[model samples]
Target: MKKVLSIGLVRGVLGQILGTAAGIGLMTAIRTAMGLGWKAEPAAVLGAFFGVFGFLIAVGVVTDWWKWAKGEETSEAEDFQETPGTRRYFGVSLDHKVIGIQYIVTSLILMAFGGSFALAFRTELASSGMQFLTFQLFNTLVGMHGMVLIISILLGIAGMANYLVPLLVGARDMAFPRLNAFGFWIAVPGSLVLLSAILVGGFDTGWTGYPPLSLRAPLGMQMFFVGVFFNGWSSILGALNLIATILRKRAKGMGMFRMPIFVWGVLATSIIAMTATQLIGLSFQLVLFERLLGMPFFDANNGGNPILFQHLFWFYSHPAVYVFVLPGLGIISELLPVFVRKPLFGYKWVAMSSLGIALTGFLVWGHHMFTAGIEDYLRVPFMYSTLLVAVPTGVKFFSWIATLWQGRIRFPVPMLFVLGGIVVFLLGGLTGPPNGTVSTDLHLHDTYFVVGHFHDTMFGGYIFPLFAAIYYWYPKVTGRKLNETLGKLHFYLMTPAFLAMTLGQMRIGMLGMRRRIADYDPAQGFGPTQMVITIAGFLVTLSVLFLFINLIRSARRGEAAVGNIWESRSPEWAILPSPAPAHNYERDFQVVGDPYDYGLADSQFVELLPQPSSDD
Candidate 1:
């Protein structure tokens, strides 16, 4: 019992419970003193707020800072040695690798919850007459599914950046390890609060939570707002940490351009995450305040412009897509050269393209408002800006194709996912212009077609690349390879299932199926298509199950992979052993050549400095 209580996660959760109770009691006391009755919504919001801080304090993520407040000194020595094994993962630690794993594991757990919500709603949509689910429940599931998966994607991005960025740059750890740990730990309680919405009365506004609708949503709305508010802190802080690490922590001779291509993607992503995440947080907070304090920020009935909400939300949310994709695209770029055994074609162009996408992403948010009654003049410019994103995106595609041209290519599990990501992302890209253009978007707005396109982008840009990264880096993290047979099974089953589902959705949507509806009329002749999508959804779920099994079984029984498994030039794989060390790089190494000069004879990317003689 003591051992379990000693775990930070357990203690944090218990702390959240106590804090929530205290908040409710305090709110009740205040209400009684004011001669008012208890209200669930305001009390719940306060409790959720208190719960987040409680989790942080109990987890000990803020312990060092707390000690610093009193002028106490905290040891900066590496502590992973003391905790030793799995226990370190459950507790607070300053190691970036452990924090990265924590973020990823939490992301997968959230994915399971989000995916489960999706499967439930997809099942309900199979035959279309709200078979088992209530109308409110269906609406709640759809919204929760979108928001939850989005949060999961953000965490997944953080996970990859945290784990790979330092190793790629030959840094000992993140520039601010404590800040990194704090960023990750805060998201735990935030996610709990987000999920707690379902336990309360679930909100009906979709994930966008547009105003007028959001103003009238139930208590759960505040939970969603508060949850996302806290999670945004993680994104903003993590981005700041990544930027500092990349700027200051590279080994000798590793100049800006010479760093691995993945670092460029992270840098571009960090730029967006740091500057733009505040808008969404502000937008959500506005709605929360409107609900709690009757602020007229988005209350249309009170002379506040509801359209203002769209601007604030999409300003962050649209660029937020690049925030999710750039790193995954980087993963694709990073791994492509290893599998193809060639230099990345147009390396500088590909790197700059990431920045280009980030810059262009900010200008394109107005495209989402084409049919939302925005002014006429803003439409064409936003349209052009939206299409401009295709240019940088096209650069990546060109680089990938050229790199694959006449190269020795291998089809590892990771390579399979990379290829799958390319195809799916291409589908997403091709479908995007229609939505970006005003005339076409007027026809397709709020339809299953848009849903299909969005899913394609997410699956292609983030999900597939994330899986590829995990498969490629698993040996480095665990000193064991995932089962190839099962991985192939996961890829084959999921890819086709996803394609079928997406295509079926687009087809039905073109045939007049709207999104977020609990039912469709039988006369619309959409039952067969919807059923196919639902079945495909289940198949995708099964494939993920296969991956989970592979991850677990292979961790213990898989083949030993202690050496360079991929034969790449990256420091993490070529120079370091499997399951990278806590401090990374026993000796300082300097960048000596191009990062992806795979086919060049006698080329080296980095050179390790020799150790000094003890006699000296």
Candidate 2:
């Protein structure tokens, strides 16, 4: 009983309840004094803010900072220490590895939640008439589905970054260990607040949360804004920590070029997170202020421009697509050479292409707004820039194919997922130009076609690759591999189902089915296609459920993996033991050879050095 109470997760939840009550009371008291009635929206906002602070305090992330404020000195080594049981994972542990595991668990939970909502809505759309969910409920589900899944993706990327980057760079831990923990811990409260939207009157504005519509949305809309606003801190601070760690903490002789290809993906992603995430935060806050303070930031009736909101929103949102995919794409590149037993065909070009994609991602946000009535000349520029992304992206796809040509290919579960990602993402890529081109976009905009295109990009670029990464690295994280048969079942079932769902969506969309509507017009001859899409959605859900079952069962009873299971050149596999120790490397190491020189005989990627003598 006492041990459970002492756990960080329990304490944080209790703290959140107390803090929320305190905030609601304070707001109610202030309103009483001002002769105004109590309002749920304002109270919820202040409560969410205080609740996050309370959770952090309870979790002890702020403990060291509190001591430092009083001129106290603490041992820096404390940050590297961790408790030896499952309890360590439930609280604020300074170990980067613990934090990384925390990220993976939380991300998977959110994915299931968001995906369930997707299935519910897809059921309602099966026959076009309202089945179980209300019209407003349907809208809320669709919007939350998008935003929550996005949060999952961000957390997923962070998990991969925290676990892999330090090991790759030969550092003991991140540049700032406490900050890394803090960045992760904050997302917990933020996600809770976001989910709280469902309890209140749900909001109807999509995740975009554009104003005018957003201004008039239910009070739950504020929670969405506040939740994302709080989560943004996680993204921003995490990026800062990663950038600093990569730049300052490389092993001896490990120059930027010599770092793992995935590190370049992390570098590019962190750049976008650092600079561009703020725009989304700022845009959401503008809407919050408009709602609470009676401001008119997007109210055209009060002299505000709705179009301006789109500009601010997409500035981060579009580049955020790159934020989502670059790491996943990097995972694809990093793993292909291993499975194919060949060198990455153009290592430097692939690395440079990540930077190119990051830089180019910023300029292409305007393409999303092409149908939204931007200037005529601006559309042409945006069109050209949007197309330019294909060049660097093409570099990646071509490089991957070249690396695989006539090599000794092994199709493990991870490799199967990697190959699947290429084909699906290519579908996404091929479908993109129609939307990027002004003429074709005029027909596809706001339709199911657009919905299909986005899903392809998301799954291929992030979700599929995420599965590959998890499968590839599961042995290193847990000294055991997932069930191979179940994994192959997952991949095979999901790929075909997803293809059907997205393709059906695109096809119906072209025949005049709109996006985000609860009921479709039966008169449009869309009944058969809608039913198929719904069935496909459920199949995808089933496949994911199998994956979860495999993970749980495998973690405890699967075959033991004591050493490098993948037979790869990366330091984590080639040198470290399976389920790497608390202190990742007992002795310092130096980079000695190429990261992906798979075909070369008698070549080593890193050379471990002896620990320093204590007597000296």
Candidate 3:
């Protein structure tokens, strides 16, 4: 009992409960003393706010910073040595690798919840006539499904960046170790608050949470707002740490252009995450204030324009898609050469294309607002800018194809996911132009077509590549490879099932089916397609189950991986051993050649310096 209680996660949850009670009691007392009636909404909001800080404090993520505030000198070395074994993961530790695993584990947990929510709703949508769920419940599921998966994706990105960036750049740890741990820990309480919305009265405004609707929503809406607001800090701070690390901590001879391709992807992603995340948080906060304080920022009848809300929300929301996918795309670029046995064709172009996609992502947010009655003059420029994103995106495709041309390609499970990501993302890309075009968007807006396209992009852009990264690097993390037979089964089942689901959604959407509805007209003959989609959704879920099973069973019993399992030239695989050490690269090394020079026999990516003898 004592051992279990000592776990930081256990203590943090206890802290949150106590803090919430205190906040609610304090708010009630203050309201009663002031001759005002107690309000559940305000009290819940305050409780949630205090609960987050309490979790942080009890988890001990803030201890080092608190000590600094007292002008006390703390030993960084002692902090690392204090925690050992798996307990380090439960408690706070400054190791980037541990934090990265923590992030990934948390992401998987959230994904499970989000995916389960989706499956429940998909089942309800199968035949149509008000099956098993209330209308409000269905709407809540739809909205939560989107938002929770989105947070999961963001956490997954941070996980990959935290674990891989420092190693890729030859740094021992992040530029700000405490900041990295803090950034990750905060997301835990934020996710809890977000999930707690369902226990309270759930909101139905969809994940966008556009105003007027949100202002009138139940107290759950405020929970959504508070949750997202806190998660935004994680993105912002993690981005700052990543950018600083990339800029300041590269191995000697590693120039901006010579760094690993994945680092460039992270660098571009961090830029957007650092700057644009504030807009979404600000938009959500404004709505929260309007609900509590009766501010008229988005109240249309009270001299406030609701369209202003759309502008601020999408400014961050749309670019956030790139933030979700760029790291995955970089994973694609980084791994493709290794499997194909060729140099990354047009490496510099691929690296710059990541930046191009991020920069262009900013100008295209207006496209989402085209149907929202923005000024007529704004639509044309937004449409053009949205279409312009394809140029950089196309460059990546061209490079991928050219690199695969006449190369010795292997069909490992990781490579299969890479290929799957390309095809799915291409379908997403092909479907995007019509939505961006003003004439077609008038018909497509708010339809299941948009839903289909979005699923394609997200699955292609993040999910597939994420699986690939795990499959490829699982050995590096655990010194054991995942079961190949199970991985192949996962890919084979998920890819075709997902394709069916998205394609079915598009078909129904083209036939005038709308999004976010609990039921459809049976007279419209949409039942069969909906059934197929639901089945496909279940199949995808089953495939993921296979992956989880593989991960657990193989962690202890799988074949041991010794050295250079993929035979790649990258520093992490080539110079470092399997299951990277606490501090990476015990000896210093310098970059000596191109990162993706795969086919060349004499090319080398890095050279390790000789160690001095004891006599010296």
Candidate 4:
């Protein structure tokens, strides 16, 4: 373990160095291409620097990723082989736990940065733009905000979870931990490339990276394309690792049905990631190469339909939503049983429901393009599929309610967040069917209504649940409990802010407001709606202060957490207080009951039927 750590540190450092150099090379090429009189623009120069630096750091970690991947051999099965200490972890380690932390930390950084950009927008929109930022800068901020948030979700949930899932489920490590790390590290270059666009040329196509407009933009579009493609690759590889691990790795008695809801959620997500995430990778890469190399894959003037790219883009990108949101659903599912004080009701149903959503999620990408000018018949099939997703989603909702029905519910901060998640997710889910139909989507398409609906679900599904997971499990990762009072305050302020902010958008959408325009037409008179959203946005910003305060304070002086804080049922809670050890359980743990059989006798817990031994 010590040896692996040293090697990991070395590799990590090296990857960062290489990545930085590569990014600078790309920047140099772009500058030359634009014929900028031997001097690069300041923003482009800065973007290239950070993008290259960030990519190098991400790629560095990929070097040690092999120890994490699966085959006949595993790091653990090798049983304490001497690993050389180097700077590899500074580059990459195959350790799922380390990679997971990398993803999580990266996501948080993006969140803070993105949120700041959003706050900038809110302030600007509050009284109309006061010339605080140029039109180009404002557009760049909006586009970058979208790109960063998407990266946060993909990296934080998918990258981090890929590393952690094997440990959480009580396997030695992920079935393909090395590949898992590789996927995650690949995202670095992509992020840097996208960032380069902002620093170097500033594309306003938004994170969706729409073509034509993107094609017409400066070198920024190409950079956005490159970054998105790399990020997509990371997701695909991470998904494949999770699927293989869940399918093959398990302690003696854990069965498919016996797998934790978190695993089920990830399992479903993996399928989506493996199958659907790839198309976007291909499309984005092709788009970048085409734009740079004059291939013109989506240029209609060259006999290519731009909308065809939209279809291909949506083919992966839509399911990518499930990839993003489903893991969040898994996080909620993992927490509710503990907070609600009951075994998850309809475990099979809830688990299967995640899979159902992932599958159905793919068929509904057309809903995004309703305004992109596709056929009329295409709309209804897309509509039906979009609406059908709600059914599986509904079943999961019912299962949560069932789990909570008449239980000894604890309203701890984590619990409060989980409840909030359900409320918001349901609100978002309910809105889908209406918009799924051709008539309704036509009305709300690209409106703030769609924007509001997604935030409710996405934030509800991801953010609240993320905090819940953080509160519920951060102790396991970092041996400290965030201040309780501050946490509660955080929840209180955030929940209302999320509601007000999201719901306000719906109101504006209903009043016939569109999205992505920097200024609203005076005829629309968006002053009041904009004000409400802006205020709600500030409230949400205020709530973030509590978290920042609490985390910083707790890290400095918070009481060390107990081994079994919250009395969690999962293996994660089984670790000791403060700095979880390598090889968490010294001995193979013998399970005697259902994971959440808190009040019931361990004997009363139904034993899931065992699986055939790996040896068999």
Candidate 5:
């Protein structure tokens, strides 16, 4: 019992519960003193703050800093020397690899919740009228689905960045190890706060949570605001840590241009996350304050412009799309050459495209607001900027195809997923230009067509690539490879289903089907299409279930895969043994050649330290 209580996760949960009660009690006391009624929104908001703080404290994320502040001596060990067991994962281990796995587990949990929400709404949409779910509940499910999946995506990328960046860069740990742990641990309380919204009357403003409507949303709306607001801290700080690590912690001879392609992707993503995340947090807080304090930040009648909220929200939200996908795209770039047995085609251009995408991502947020009553003059420029993203994005596609030209390509599970990403993302890219044009967007905006395009982008840019990464790296993390048959099954089932679902959505969307509605008209002739989409949605879920089964069953039972499982040229695989050591690299390495010198004989990406002779 004591051992369990000592676990950071358990302690953090208990602390959050007590802190929540205390926050509510404090709010009640303050209201009583002021002769005002106790409010759920204000109390919940305070409770959220306290809950997160309490969790951080209980997890001991700041213990070393606190000790320093008290003028006490502290151990300088970078490795936490965590005991070898599952219990270490529950506690705050400063090891980057352990933190990475923690992020992956947390992401999967969130994905399960978010995907369940999606299935619920998808079932409701199968037939026009609502089935077993109230309109408000359905609305909440849809909104929750979006936000939860987004948080899951962020965590997924963070997991990839955290685990891969250090080893790839030849660093022992992150530049700020405690900060890395803190950034990850914070997501737990943040997700809990977000999920608590459903119990608090639910927010129906969609993930964007634009104001006016948001100002008048239920008490649960505050939970949603507080959830994403806190999650933003994770993103911002994680990005900061990654940028610092990559810039300062590279192996000897590793330069900015010589880093792995995925590292560049992370670099671009971190830049966006660090700079743009604050806007979303700021926007959500404004709405929270408006609701709790009766401030009119977006209340037009009270002299606040509602459109101002959109500007602030999308400024981060659109770039946030890049934050979610750049790493996946980087994964795609990183893995393509390995399997294709070719040097990454146009390496400099591919590296620069990530930054180009990040920069162009910022100027294109206004495209989402083209019909949101923004200035007429602004729409044209926004359209152009939105269209400009395709250029650098196109460079990536061409380069990938070129890299695969007549090469000895291997179709492993990871490669299958990489290929899947290309096809789906290509669909997403092709469909985007139509929306970039104002006339076409006027027809397609707020319709299932837009939803289809967005899903294509997400699946292609993140989900598929994420699966590829997990499969490719599972061996390194677990010292056992996932079942090839199960992985192939996962891909085949999911790919066809997702493609059909999204394509069906686009087809019906052009026929006038709107988005986010719980029910639709039977006369619209969309029943068959909706049924197909719903069925496909369930199939995708089943496919993911297969993946879960594969992961669990294969962890102990799968083929042992120690030592350069993929025979790749990346630093981590070339040097580290399976299940990578706590501190990655027992000795420092030097970058001696190109990151993806796949076909070059006698070429090495990094030079490992010399081992001492047994005679000595």
Candidate 6:
């Protein structure tokens, strides 16, 4: 881990410093000695390359001459030992459980950061102008928040599924554990690059990074490109790892059909992430070249069409929706069985719907650009594909409602979040059919209607379930109980506020209010909905404050929890400790019956943990 960091950090820093001197010296010597004028940019880039080479030489010398001699890698290893207060989590820990926990922690931190940006944007809106920040700053905040949350949402699913799915399917670790670590580490630096946009300048393209507009922005746009590029790499790696794991690592009895619906959703999501992420990465890299090296990919003056960037970008990004939402659907599938006290209805159908969503997701990217004036003939196929998505989505919705009806229901935080997601996602889906229609989208193309619909699907999909999943699995992760009263308080405050904020957005959109516009005349009808959304935004912000407090108060000082607090049906929950040890499952436990047999079999129980050794 230290080697990786040293290689990246020292090499970059030295390359910049020495490269600057080398270029300046060369340029001065050329003009002075030869009396010949030439361009400076090429020399500067070459110099930076030379400086980077020098750093590599230093690295080789240090490693071969000293660090590698007398077993320094082993002896000097203690130097890299984590200090008590240092960021210990940045190291490589290939344990699926550790990586899973890391993903959750990372996304949570980024979520807070993203939510803070949302608050700032809301504050600016509340003042109806420059009260908290300037116009550029507001735009930057909104854009960064959107990007951060999008990245966070994508990774958070992989993380939760990583921790839960293997155990749910009775597997030991991922199919490729080392690659899993690499997948997660990629996101760490990617997030840093994204956040750096705020310091350098700011990207106003939002996460969408629409071209022509993106090309016209400041150098900060380059930072956005770098960050997003790295994030795409992470997604690709995770998707590949997950697909491989699901295919090869299932328990003895669990086959593709027998696997839990949650795992199936992850499998579908992995496929989408694997195949779709590359287009976005390549598209963004093309934009980066155009910005940094004056490439002609999107340059209209150079005969390159900027619209091509949009086509390639949304080709991957539109499916990126399923990348985010499908995992939440998986979570809901997992939760329904536990809380509603019933086997998931139409398990086969629900599982297939996940794959259905993924396969069809690729065909719908054109829907995003209905207003961009693509070929007239192209619109109909894209519109049809876009509407085709609704069928699979609707199937999952019906399955959930069917599961909940006439069952022994428990209204816990997890169930609440799942139910909330179902309701809100339905509302979001209602707007989608409109967007699919060429005529309707022409009017609502860039309006707040788009904003409202996404928040409904995204927040309900990611944020709401995130809290629910956290609470559901808290005991297993931390070996402690979260304060129930505080958890309920957190839930009540958050859900209503989110509805207020997102629902209010729907009204603004219907009233023909445009998105990304700073302000308008106070006399217009936009004022009421604008004020309502702003006020609701603050309410949601306050709700987050309560959640943070609950997490902080619970993780450390909360009472130690017992294993299987819910008497969970799965084998992973049958451990002796609250949070299971490094390798879960005792030797005494062997496959006997299905996990959801409930109280049907007296012989279903197995001897707990610390399985017999070879000697025994």
Candidate 1 TM-score versus the reference: 0.99
* Per-residue alpha-carbon lDDT of candidate 5 for residues 1-616, written as tens digits (9 for 90 to 100): 9978978899999988988888988998999899998777777799889988888888877888899899998776473567569888998888999999999999999999999999999999999876799988988999999999999999999999999999999999999988898899999999999999999899777878877778878888899999998889999999999999999999999988899999999999999999999999999999888888888999999999999999999999999989988999999999999999999999999999999999999999888877889999999999999999999999999999999998899999999999999999999999988888888998898899999999999999999999999999999999999999999999999999999999999999999998888899999899999999999999999999999999999999999997788988888899889989878899788889999889989998888767767896
Tell me the whole-model lDDT of each prediction, alpha carbons only. 0.93, 0.91, 0.93, 0.73, 0.92, 0.74
Q: Give the Å error, residue 43, model 5.
A: 1.4
Clashes of each: 0, 0, 0, 45, 0, 1
Deviation (Å) of 169 in candidate 5: 0.7
Please give, for residues 1-616, the per-residue lDDT of candidate 2 as tens digits: 7877788888898888888888988999999899998788888888888888888888878888998899998768444456568889998888888889899899999999899989889889999789999989999999999999999999999999999999888888888899999999999999999998877877898789977889989988988998898889999999999999999999998998898999999999999999999999999999899999988888888998889999999999999999999999999999999999999999999999999999999998888887888999999999999999999999999999999999999999999999999999999999999999998888888899999999999999999999999898998888998999999999999999999999999999898888888887689899999999999999999999889999999999988987777888887887789898877888888988989999899988898887788996
**Poorest stretch of ten by lDDT in candidate 1:** 75-84
Query: Which 10 consecutive residues of model 3 have the lowest summed lDDT?
Result: 74-83
Off by over 4 Å in 5: 77-79, 611-616
Which pairs clash inside model 1? none
TM-score of each: 0.99, 0.98, 0.99, 0.87, 0.98, 0.86
**Candidate 6 stretches greater than 4 Å from native:** 1-90, 586-616
Flag the better candidate by lDDT, 1 or 5: 1
Q: Write the per-residue lDDT of candidate 4 for residues 92-198, one digit (tens) a residue.
A: 55666666777776787778878888888777776654548666767777888877887888787875475457756677677875576677666655665666667
Which runs in model 3 stand beyond 4 Å of their true positions? 77-79, 612-616
- lDDT for predicted candidate 3 compared with the true structure: 0.93
How far residue 338's Cα lies from its native spot in candidate 1, in Å, is 0.5
Give the alpha carbon lDDT tens digit for every residue of 1-616 in model 1.
Answer: 9988988999999989988888888888889899888898888988998888888889888988998899998878365343668999998888889989999999999999999999999999989576899988888999999999999999999999999999999999999989999999999999999999888888899999998988888888889998999999999999999999999999999999898888999999999999999999999998898888888988767889999999999999999999999999999999999999999999999999999999999999999899899999999999999999999999999999999999999999999999999999999999999999999999998999999999999999999999999899999999999999999999999999999999999998888899999998999999999999999999999999999999999999999997898998999988998889889888999999999999899999999988878997
Model 2 off-target regions past 4 Å? 77-81
Q: Per-residue lDDT for 507-540 in model 3, tens only?
A: 9998889999888889998999999999999999
